[model samples]
Target: MRETLAKWRPAIDEAIADLIPREIDVDYLESFFGEATYEYDPDGLQRALSDPIWELLDRGGKRWRAVLFLVFIDAFGEDPAAYLPYACIPEILHNGTIIVDDVEDEAAMRRGEPALHHLYGEDVALNAGNAMYFLPLKILTRDPANLPADRRLAAYEMLMDELNRTHLGQGMDICWHNERDVRVTPEQYLEMCACKTGCLGRIVARLAAIITDQPAEVEEAVARYAELTAVAFQIGDDILDVENSLGRAGEFGKEFGNDIREGKKTLLVIHAIEKSDPERARRLQEILQADTNTDEEVLEALSIIEDTGGLACARERALDLAAEARAEIDGLDFDPGTVDKLHEFTEFVIDRDA
Candidate 1:
């Protein structure tokens, strides 16, 4: 899986660069946005947009979502390289989300460095992040792939629906984290993950199916696989946060117990709260509800999760979901190599330490 990702990184990075250049200039602006209604300020734009956007991009990310799109294209019997511009959509939007998420979460670090909002003021970061949500829409408007009108329309509608769903998921998460009294059931957590995490992966799968003109049944099947994989990946992420805080895993980027600091209602916290003794459960709730916590408090929270088997339970659930994700495509007509890659993709999402 790592080898496949490494092999594709250069192409994915190049596609990203083509969409958002190293430097913003008049020519790029004219090409992307039609002739300016008034004079444009290249310098101001560069400072506010290009510099900070690339600052986050240059800090590495797995770019797995983009790869997932391409792999789905291949699975659907199409030339993945032909859709490179479209592939950039999910990757760029993902970075945008994380930048905004950092600000909202009051995150101290991202990708092992200060959050974008910290380096650039909140206004600049917010605008830049918001711009990313629209920047990639240029691909759709330009019709660079010369896609059929219906296919293009499908893509547009998919983006709108999925992006809106993402906000809904984010809203649920924020409301839970900010309030201590909201008890998030495991089922509710999975639903939130499906909306927040699964939506992007659905974009990848559905976009591929749309471009390739796959049958409706096939599209649904492939999308289900992608969504399940994404949810499992999110669970793995929650586990890694706890593991890194416990010194059970190496750096996964972000701070240790940052989730605890944010008072995130992660699956681990949910399980631990439900399974612990009443006194311990109340203590856990009090710790999470507090405005601030010491390192010792964070460690205490992690210990409670570990001792109550929250970590183990979450891990088991993640693995089960991964297995179910693999099963989603078991009867598909993909070639042998694509099947292996798909299986590996499912495994990578859940098993990855980072």
Candidate 2:
């Protein structure tokens, strides 16, 4: 993972820096927000978000999936600026999703600080997330001259579609928390990942292809391929959440380990329940259902996960998805170097420490 990132990092960094014009690029994002404001103070909103949301973005880990779109656009001879507005859309949307997710999960910490809702109260935090969510698409609709009317319309449509899929997936995830008694099959878990993570990632990939005006068939194929890659990414996240404590600390540069405590029906946890001895499974089920459980109880549940083999199965399945994505992308006309870079990006997702 380190090697793959070291190779791609410089390229992505340079590309992102040049995505917007030099003059405005050097100006602060808040300044732009200031310019576009409705003459009212967002004081409360600012206080709630100024730290957690921006810090979350700035304390960046690997931003591979977003970079994939920017670089893919570069591949087709378009300037990276051609897609600059949308470049950060995926990240913003992802962060907004996390904000809502933390409140829904009643999560306590975010990047070593209190989760937004925990710090600012749920209603305020949700409003903060809504504000953040609006910026990405608003930016996407910027520069009408850069994006043609048809392309602009297409971008909005895809953006809304991506958000809808993610919201639906999150609803399923939240519902699973309350319905822990139900069995979740491996196939079902994969579908869940597709809705949650895969959909947005694939949206960006397909959008990248769309900017090139690639044939409909080709764009669909690339999106389908990217969809699988996204699933692998989310599966890897489930593994990290159960197997590692990084999310709590913010030290590993990646959030970790809430899925189990929150009873997310990730493939890893589901498989463990499906595979455990009846007695052990019962113990885990108790932990899952324990809303009043202390951190110690959560730790005990972690112990159960350690003894079960479900986490390893999740890792294996993620790798399989990556392989499938690579095979599908190989069918496209992407340049050899681009294909290699993309493959590196895919493999790195599961292998990554963050």
- Local distance difference test, each candidate: 0.87, 0.68
Error of 2 at 161 (Å): 1.8
Off by over 4 Å in 1: 247-256
Which ten residues in a row are the worst by lDDT in model 2?
Answer: 18-27
Q: Tens digit of lDDT per residue, candidate 1, span 113-137?
A: 8999999999999999999999987
TM-score of model number 1 = 0.94
Candidate 2 per-residue lDDT, tens place, 220-292, comes to 7778777888888888877777657523533432333455556666675677778788887888788777765
Runs of candidate 2 with Cα error greater than 4 angstroms are: 1-39, 42-53, 241-259, 292-308
What's every prediction's RMSD, in angstroms? 2.4, 5.4
Model 1 Cα shift for residue 3 (angstroms) = 2.3
* Best by the TM-score measure: 1
Model 1 residue 244 CA deviation in Å: 3.7
What's the true lDDT of residue 304 in model 1? Answer: 88
TM-score to native of every candidate shown: 0.94, 0.78
Clash list (residue pairs), candidate 1: none
